[model samples]
Target: MKAPRLHIPIHYLKGVGPRLAGDLEHLGIKTIDDLFAYYPYRYDEYELKDLAEVNDQEQTTIVGKIQSEPLLHYYGKKKSRLTVRILSGKYLIQVVLFNRPFLKRTLTLGSVVTVTGKWDRNRAMLTASEIHAGEPDPGSKWSPVYTACSGISVRKLRALVKQAFIQYPDCIKENLPAAFIERYRLTGKREAVRTIHFPEDQEQLRQARRRLVYEEFLLYELKLHAYKQLKRVSQNGVQMNIDRPAVQKFIEALPFALTAAQERVVNEILSDMGAAFSMNRLLQGDVGSGKTIVAAIALYAAAVSGYQGALMVPTEILAEQHADQLDGLFAPYGITTGLLTGSVRGKRRGTLLRGLAEGKINVLVGTHALIQPEVIFRKLGLVVTDEQHRFGVRQRGALRLKGKEPDILYMTATPIPRTLALSVFGDMDVSTIDQLPGGRKKIKTYWVQEKIIDRVIHFMRNELEQGRQAYVICPLIEESEQLDVQNAIDVYTHLSQALPEFKVALMHGRLTPEEKEAAMDAFKKKEVQVLVSTTVVEVGVNVPNASLMIIYDADRFGLSQLHQLRGRVGRGNVQSYCILLADAKSETSKEKMRLMAETTDGFKLSGYDLKLRGPGDFFGSKQSGLPNFRLADMIHDYRTLTVARDDASRLVKSHEFWHADCYAPLRETLAESGLTQTVHLD
Candidate 1:
């Protein structure tokens, strides 16, 4: 049988054999479609310019004839340079090339060539970045620059692409409707695919890129909208009875009043819970915002409705913190609260598991242990996950699976930008607690050098002496030979000696669950006046008495993280302060420090952080949980993303679009887009 057109294996291409195909596979190009989808990361523009018109340090392309022999010089080990003098018009430009001694054999004397790079006009020098043997063509000014690896040159890949297009010119068909394309002024799918690799002009290239980006965003948004519709139409939720009187009574008995923001979020959550559809809401709040109290109301609603409520936190310490607060808050209302962490084992674990199975546990709070197989719930109606990003999708899904169809609520203290929130958590309804509790003061922040650290420590000691606790945060758990930053172990040792009169303890990820609990418990009880720890304590370790926080290598962290670390203090009204100890070398790091010292708004900081670090680095260690789009950027192309989302919303609103014959191509492309696999619509 003849080879397929669009789905043909890459090895079957005109020039790419099995060996070359293996190299292409490493770049995720295994078939004809994959090869086409692998778009260039950037483009290089080479425009023929007069030597007199080019300025120093400006990039320009010049055509010249080699007037001298190319000299090859070897400098550093495994490094060589090729130098040649080329006569262009009245200017004899000296061209320098690095690590390409083989070019000396190809560049013959008196041969006409085109060179592109930064111009050193004063010295009549052109540091050649790209050199072509023939004179440059003004018509073909733009060259596609693809990411390449060893054994697979970009030139070879470009040649293969050109051959593939020529061989299968009609392989790609239109997946988008003609009307949608005309309305958006998007180029045809096949035209865009061809022009993206070999554009005739800049305007055509721009249109091609825009067309591809729009399609990527539109398909992703369609999946998100489809997921929302599926949840609403297919999944039946538990219709919970709203015990308004009991809820109000519980709220009235609280020691502190809830902010308006908290009340509004609570109302939004409760309305979702009481609806016919299951609730899938994300609760976003800044640090120190009363998110816990809002979650408490939802949990209480579940409990009073005669259903069990489960709250999962990231760390065991956070679990204990929630369990303690919930126990005190629920004890008076005749509701039983239980904690199940990795450390809670043997008979206690069995008793807790038995309580959960028998419906005796009204509210359960724990870490990953809550997802254990034996931890069955009699009626798990509502599930709340704190720091939801910390757990993988499977972990959260496993807990949700424990219930028949539980209302899901995900809470995060890290504030996400609205654009990102829409894309990443598109399937969930979002509620943001924008206001902090009344009477909460902003944490006074300071960026100090290492030389002034002694003064900062003295101030910390003064605060400790005044009966307030403090925290010393280090970036590393232990000493690192590669890094010159302070570690928790060394910081603890230094603090223990520097402040000999005060009690100090160490907390890090290496500590056992039991040990971490003990250290946190001691800090809670004021048994330890100073706690030197790593980022393991970055999340939710509420201590109202801890009025000071000192972070070492603070610049090493992203703005969101530094804000989270700063939030560890300022829990009470004792006038908290956070001193960032960092010798920030780069201007970017210095700007981060200045921004931190300038503002306490977590949302503001997070927005700046997203813009500064981009979406991938914003979440730090964890994947941004965003679909990988070849041409669309969540941050840079936010406006296009918004338009695509609106269009998708309109499209998904009509049921016919899901099964109409005209939409079959879209559905097929969507299946291959990989967005549906990332999002669960069923």
Candidate 2:
């Protein structure tokens, strides 16, 4: 029978049986395409050197015929040695291998051997580090080393790949357009893949790798540019005549003046809203940098323009918190506000939903409940979603569908650098509130060992004695099946017992809505001196009385989460402290803790975290709305990304470029990527 295509399952191949295919699947080599895509992690180089050319104390690999069987000698119980000699170019080279006596059978006389080791000048010997009983290929200077599994060896994998290339050369055909490749001076896809697998030298490998990396960036940039183009078109949106004088008056009435960055972003949002098309923008700010205030300004403009506005947050606690703050922030301008959440239902929900539909509630603040099928806006002109990474693109789209493409503003507290933010979310116009409000207290952070648990508690007790509250955050709400981390309930119970003089309480995900609210309410009211909880409190929890936050196993959380948790404290003018207690004692954990203690700048921490955890992990959960790129490294390959972005822009704007036949493959690739669904506001 004819051989199956490269896309066929690996078991159909010559040597990969069902058992072997299962083993190969673990290395992400399920199909022939996957096997070809599996690039080597590193390379081993060997130079065929003669004994006469080899230096006395230099590391080298030499291939020659063995003169005799390896002689074995033992010293004491564990020490053993095997001495062998090889003849190369009429010169004799002494080789000594320690502890591996099994080589006596493989290194027998008349057998060709390859030995690599450091030469010992005094003994005129080359102490063997690795010995192969075969003549090394003279033409090849390097050997590819792939990531392997338990059941697979390097030899078997190399042979399988060689067989694949030889048998199915058609499978590695170049698919990119010829003209484009020539213009960019890029190698063909076929040549690139071949050179990547087995390059003649470093220069060849470099050229091949460059082509693949650039292609990865180009594809990603195309998707991003397409999303941007599709989203920028004019839509039948709610056209607003923003009252500039009234808006300026409202800003002046606020207790604190708006920062320069905040004023500029507000103007940008207002300009977009007044345009005929819908406004799709992202408001990125650091923790406590006053992003909500900027969002409120946009909502106020919409409300005063005789249209409804809605702000969606991530958690109920944050929803309630924003509603309370917005109620006060906008109340002076006679702009009414309402709250809608999962907790508000039945007649209350019915009445709230009715008020929203009738325009009685000018601005509605809530969690995801704002997008429920039952909820309706009378004349929705603005929609703002906070902590945008926590929600999926589909969920945000559902919210937008509630109105006629109302102006959308997605807010995130994670402080990504400007370049990366633009590259990742190229579909949306970015506005950053880089400056925090003036006179904010700088939070002091410290890393403490687990052995000083009592001392840490005593310090917190002192803060509590002075009429301040504290937060004790655990990594888990309850015992986890996989991890041995501290749980909130256990920590709460221990704290309550250890400090009977002060009221302590536990809050976690398992608690009912009312129970959770009650615990948070008590803590907010200072009825509970210490609040023990998981990351539930990371979303914009405003408790100024809480001055101390002690996170147990802080290494378990992401850098942004840790920053948000630290933001919980230092809200007021009082000095705040964040103590991280890590017990894992590993280098990774120590580095994480040290980074937390060293800097309070979220942007710097984010870059550092991205460097440590790769773009896939750093972008956050799948719900974060970041595309899964298989090759692009946003941190390291930024220059390539910039070039590709420009290339995509140039192509998209050029009518002649799109009309070419070479654009066929680009169009096909884009169709399969689902770029519209991945990044859309309507």
Candidate 3:
């Protein structure tokens, strides 16, 4: 079937020229589909009411003739004000405006103007927020306030959207099954799109959004199921039989018993690996939730089947840490573990690579170096990735191709919100380790202004004196040429001067890799008492002795980002504290920081972060292989997500929709939505 002309350039649409097209592109509306999909973030009710009808503290618009010319006045040297009086029948409306001296010339006596603002009955005045010379633009009772650029007016966007709706009502054909839409009580696509932009009432808008959100989620969920199926097609790897005696011996040697959550997730991974299909699962746990141990158990299970396993991390430090750990865990059990990273010397790296290719290495851990063509594996049956988001989707695909469809395990410290996990990781089965291990301490967090930096430093000193380390994270690595934000170098210098007794060091992206490793190694070995750094340390720093996270300009970070920084501390049981010495300028930033101080749950923080920044900036949809919803908010429409997921799962698995010609259109729709990159079959 031919696709509709929805992809046509939006400039060709009636009343939109090249100038308006450029403005529309800023709003990501290059095509008719883009314009229609660009829904309003908010709405304004421009209900015009009589001066006598408006109640105090109500915002409304009024049309009246100015009875007098604007009276201009100066309030001190810093303020200029313009005041005007309008007559509506016998009711005289006093309008006061500020910082609008140009309005003095615009407000002519006996001129008709529309004023919108709040009425203060006690003061007998109307504080005008906007004064229009003519009738309200679009002249509708309800007006949409789109997320627009400075050059594109909402009135212009509304007009353009209305024209597209009229010209292309048939563009969004009734491809959706009638029975399906009826079952969900969803309005038709054409009707829903019309109502979304210009609703008759709040009820209509709600109905329209419900339909749009559900359809988006349903198609997205279907694609996820397809992707999972596509990846597991060659799941012909050896079934990793569970050797209980060896596993028991390994667990007995651990310093601590696995938490119930960790044990349960290990069982899940084991079950997946033992199945005919290759195990594709996500091991989601909060920072310090012991996901590494769970993954270790899975690796042991894979090795028990006489096949090799590879664990990949984002940084060389994390790779080395995992190798150091796995060596200790797997060595006594007669499982040979190896490390292959960029920094490994010639002879040692050569031996490790040869051992891996010869199947002598039972488990190998490294960074992107693991995916290099030369780092061949003999029988790679399992692939484990720590900090999964640190690597791109293509990187994961590359690693998987090294083996004959190896069982994959992804480990993430980022606790994805339940809604997001269902949508984003729908292709992979998710096993969450929700509980911290026994004796884990909850990190006490504090939100304070930068004025209290002295007190925070004193606390840091007290911790350091007890043989603990602290981290000071600045928002920037160097003083930006434009912005006045704090940087790592200046923070290190300032901290060194103020706390002269401690060994303070600095690190940033600008430093060579070796220098960065040296600085981090020094901190890890307690050679540096305080480390001043940027977000570089945000990902894989796992120092247990670091008990204090002193973040400068903490308000400059998003909730999840601040939470991740806080996760750097609290890794040890040393009564860790996260002191946010932030100078929050707005109430929104203050609220965000307060939420950070209130809870350590990354899932909750993720929800708040999504709401604050939307899905586009939440994470890279392209790199992460997750869809960026144009309409549906995964958090707000969580129920819809679940419903759609279940329905999509059922449809994808059922005989009729699974292989029937009737489902072709839906598959095509999914392909058009860009799911084909990850979810479509060959």
Candidate 4:
């Protein structure tokens, strides 16, 4: 069926004008299609009760007779109130409106009206902002409640929404195939859209929600599968027949031995590089899991073959750190290393570019500046991205385009659950370094209440006296005087005054890039004994000397974030510790904190975190660009998502349906959803 065309201007719609159209635009609604797809955050139901059966304090709607006109009373100094007496059979209930004296003109005595609002039993008053005259219609149940601004009430939005639906076009096209819908037990698109706004009953609402949620997850999975297929078919990478003897010599010369897990993953990466196709792989490891060594080994192999390797980091601090560390490691093998960042300028940058283009720099480490047009490589063979989440698809592609489609290796410390990883990075093969390096000690964790903050500070001071550095993290930068949680600035001030003898540095999201770098450098060099910061330090910057990490209001952060913060202190083997300060009264908060205290394993913690808080907290829907499903619970809906993945994979593999005309609408829908734009499938 052809979709109906409905393109009426907002002003032409019933009960809407220029002023209201502008308000609707603020909510991202500009067209009829937009209004139809704008789902409600939640719904409020008013139970119907007879006037005689109405009791004070019970939230119910009742039909009653207004015995007296609402009288407007001014109660001194900009205070006003409206009161009306209503007769409900033998009982008389007083209706009160606060700060709304205009209701007196709208409501009159001797009119039968139905009122719905909160009932205050102790005061014998029914406070209502929504009161309609005449008897309530039995069919007028399950009112559609919409999100509204300060001036726009739910009733007003509801009326506009109802008009939109009534004027909605017929024959809305179904994007999914008939066979797919039947197998998944999903409602048709037209019916789902109609029922979601004006459901016949609760069951219809549930079915509509299920259909839409399934469609979203299905489309997302399909896009991921398509990207994976395209990458496998199109890209032809150089097979690196790397010298294994060189790799073995470097490993033997190392101060430490490689773990079995690390060795296995490195071998797998090497095997992929040796294959005809280009390697697009992810190296996932927990904090302190020695991933950098594996990466360095890969770059070393590439360098030994007279090819250049590029390591791109998200931050200048991380790039500098990588360059410094790699410079030390590669110097023994007579390999030249160069650093490139936004801060590197003039002669230094020009010389580095010249060295790279001349094949003098064997290993290059930098931030996104490495992908700049001016930076050229003589024989770029491998591209390694650190903390892959910070770089988007375009940035990664730009780096690959720099040299002959270099084998891409993306590294992430954020241990994603297997299910979520499939959806987020399904295009790449994943290798997890589950084992930590030998001799790395687990950081002891403690959850303390705010009352014992003074004692905690004393302990931190003692640690500082022993030549140890500490990290104090806050959720926000400046103090929101209204909010009770500690901010970085406020904590910095308090810590400075409390520990007047020690040096303190403050860093937050609001700081300038140079200022943040300076603050981080001071803390890294031990110039600052304590560094107060936000989650900006969650990744990249590594200070092995910082042995203490104290997170204020630990309950405010997600489980994965708390784990990432704790990972910062345990980098060095100096018996590090993490202290989570939280409110003791909240049992839920205590439970989440206990999860952090029990284990130091990030992969296990990620799974438990997903189960405890649900997958919604894993990537933070806003940050991950993943759809937020209304009906599908990440924890409970994993089975459905997996099923959808399997079905999508099968459909794509079997070309029988790929060329079918039935899929044209589905393809068009995918294009409209912006999924196609993100995944540039060839």
Q: List TM-scores for all candidates, in order.
A: 0.89, 0.78, 0.79, 0.77
Model 2 lDDT per residue over 1-682, tens place: 1122337677866888888999999988887778878888776668777666767788888777888777999998988999988886676878999987877777779888887788776676888777787877666767777878888877678778888888766676464678768888998898888888888899999889888888888877787777666666534667799998988998998999999989989999999899777888989988888999999999999988998999999888888999999999888778889998889978988888888888889999998888889898999999999988888878888999999989999999887876568777757778888888999889999998878989999999999999999999999887888987888988998898888999998888889878989999999999999999988888888999999999998888878788889999999989999999887567877888889999999888887888878777877565444655555577887777778777887776666544566666675567666642322222
Task: Please report the candidate that would top TM-score against the real structure.
Answer: 1
* Residue range with the least summed lDDT across 10 consecutive positions in model 1: 673-682
Q: Each model's C-alpha lDDT?
A: 0.87, 0.83, 0.82, 0.81
Model 1 deviation from native, Cα RMSD in Å? 3.9
Report lDDT (Cα) of residue 162, candidate 1. Answer: 85
Candidate 3 off by > 4 Å: 1-46, 51-140, 143-185, 188-190, 230-245, 480-485, 620-622, 656-682
For model 3 the local lDDT of residue 164 reads 89
Pairs in clash, predicted candidate 3: none
TM-score: which is higher, 1 or 4? Answer: 1
TM-score, model 1 to reference = 0.89
**Residues forming the 10-long window of minimal summed lDDT in candidate 2:** 673-682
Q: In each prediction, how many residue pairs overlap at the backbone (N, C-alpha, C within less than 3 A)?
A: 0, 0, 0, 0
* Model 1: per-residue Cα lDDT over 170-274, one tens digit each: 667787888888888889999999899878788999999999999989888888877787677664987799898999999999998889999899999999999
At residue 219, candidate 4 shows an lDDT of 73
- Considering every candidate listed, which one attains the maximal lDDT? 1
A best-first ranking of the candidates according to their lDDT comes to 1, 2, 3, 4
Q: Local error of candidate 1 at 615, Å?
A: 1.6
lDDT of 2 at 277: 76
* Cα lDDT of model 3 by residue, 1-682, tens digit: 3342346788778988888888888888888877778888877677777767878899878788899878989888768888998986677879999877878888998888888788998887888876768767663666777876788766678878889887766555555677788898999888988888887788989999999999888888887876666656645655767787777777778988888898898878888888778888888887778888888988998898888999999887778778998999888889998887788878898888888889999999998989898888999889999878888888989999999878999988777765467577656789988887778788999999888778888888899999999989998887899877788889888899988988999988888878888999999999999999988898867899999998888888888888888999988767999988877889889889889889988877877887887766777665455567878877678889989988888776666664466666676776685545333234
Candidate 3 displacement at residue 534 in angstroms: 2.8
